[model samples]
Target: MLTERWRETLVDTYGTPPIGLVSGQGATLTDEKGNSYIDLLAGIAVNALGYGNEHVAQAVYHQAQNLVHTSNLFATQPVLDAGAKLIERVGDVNARVFFCNSGAEANEAAFKLARLTGRRRILAAKHGFHGRTMGSLALTGQPDKQNAFRPLPGGVEFYPFGDADYLRQLVELNPEDTAAIIFEPIQGETGVIPAPDGFMQKVNDLCEEYGILLIVDEVQTGVGRTGTFFAHEIEGVRPDVITMAKGLGAGVPIGATITRGRARDLFTPGTHGTTFGGNPVACAAANVVLDTVDAEFLAEVTRKGDYLRQKLENLPNVDHVRGRGLMLGVVLNAPVAKQAVRGGLEKGLILNAPKENVLRLTPPLIISQHELDTALNTLRTILEELA
Candidate 1:
């Protein structure tokens, strides 16, 4: 009944609802039909603390009872606390935060910030996905998404991701008019592709050389997903603008664009705004997520990610694995990822295929070692059956 209702009421965008989840706790989910599955996707990495976390739930409950939203017209404690926490996490002395409601909005804010630099052109990495909105969509390099919506806010170009030489050439070619160079430290949707060695530093060098703003989209890789609070932290690169959303609020719906140095002053009053941005309840939830993801827990995430990757490397039909920390992509020898996903579901394990031959895994940060072992064993069984 829920599936039928979804088909009738919802747009035909996601094809179909795979299952109606009734409840979740930690790394596990239960469907309406009483089937339980180990959730490896974690709501596409937004469920950082996993489902039914008492701390997050309490935060949301208390905040909602007190205040949910006040728009940007008035100041609220939750929003202020959330912003301060974000600034603290960024560790940028001059950074200021703009809170929105999703990754797309965060990127949208970043795009507008770039435009304020008086340069029109924006360079992004090939196969990089920003969001589905118009501004962020224009910055996205995936042709399939852009082809339909032609004439989408021009002055955007694409360079090969992880190819520093190509990026240098492109930046050199459009030196004068290039406003910003936006990219994901690790491309998540096109499969988990991490930045090549020294590539991020090279990009930073080029951006500095050309006076172009460096915009790192950390929507999927931020907030302890990549073992660090931010993926670029590993590279020690200072970006002018950083967009983040997923895992920030631990599934409470929040987005943030952190701007530092001169970039922070680019937007003054009347330049930009949002109605539901920086919502109080969402900010309250985000504060808890930020407080919980400490240095020690992030270190454990790194260890677990290493363990999971090593286990997959020895699995059948897995050609290679890429990505950092818990964010991973399993590249298969054949185009059996969809089959593997189906088999995984049948075997009571939730997995996703972001690409035809690549399986993306972004389990909860609090996932146990036993759960990881179970997921690996289930994946091996699925791979053997597909092979």
Candidate 2:
């Protein structure tokens, strides 16, 4: 089977697979052995419309038949339309879109945009996961993942997440040297932690006062994953720059860096470039994802998120519930996140542990109430048994 061949041929980065997934529809995936599991991770928050969505599939097919790629040398309709739609939804008149292939690349583009202003330093929050590429890796805050690649791009500083006063001090300390402050609205890799109340607004104010660009990394929280199109919309503070990917193209790979006001003009024609960035198929898929996640759908996401949070809080071993909308983290009393994940898998559910003590849940926005209840029941039973 291809699974066996993969073990022998593939790189060791992702390790071995637990099961051979054959097909998926909505929030359910069936393994090769015909065992079905309810997907709670949503491919790490990338499948905004779930799997095999009709609109997304149709868009991809139609675009594939029309035009797939023309490179950045020429503009394509799908790419142009997608960019316009994004800027409109973001509600920033000065915003311009730069398309790329993944979350890391979008961030890499953001770093370059910040550097183009001729500033050397960028400030990011601790426990953040930007990406593995050199530029984004420099901004990433995890020491364990970065130690192997020592001497990353210099002039990157880490502040404690959601500490406005500390951030103010850092800005005051290096006002001239600092170019930008980049952070995730909800820290995805560090257990889906949301910025504390009034934290983002304070940071925005400080960035403006100090002349430092604000970059919000919404890779995991964008495209209706967090109940809003962008997580920063909830705070009502528009960032000078924003990076997006993950669910941008549903399951298709795509990323974008959106710059606002004067920052949009920083990149010259040849200063930055990418191949296969705004391919017709990917952009088409993304447009479908955006159209599918309209205002009504977002309201449903909020309702489901509240229901899920309430259910999680009532579970026997759950200590706390965190995050907004569909992007949620279940904090366990003990460091049993891995155990709970394994238990859930055994009971025909799919979940993930982003950190040692937090079970992260990013189910599809379109997940029905019945499916959600089923997954919750299975989780409740597992948690009770563990307790």
Whole-model lDDT per candidate: 0.92, 0.91
Per-candidate TM-score against the hidden true structure: 0.99, 0.98
- Model 2 alpha-carbon miss at residue 160, Å: 0.5
Q: Which candidate number maximizes lDDT? A: 1
Query: lDDT tens digits, residues 62-174, model 1?
Result: 98898877899999998889888888888876799999999999999999999999999899999999999999999999999999998899889888999999888888886
Residue pairs in collision within model 2: none
Q: Any idea what lDDT model 2 has? A: 0.91
| Candidate 2 residue-wise lDDT, 1-387, digit = tens | 557877999998998777789899989998888899999999999988888798898899988888888998888889989999999998876689999999999999989988988888899999999999998999999999899998999889999999999988988887998899999999989999999989999999888887788999999999988888899989898798899999999999999999996478999988999989998899999888877789998999999999999989999988899999999999999888888888987999999998778999999888988899999999998888888
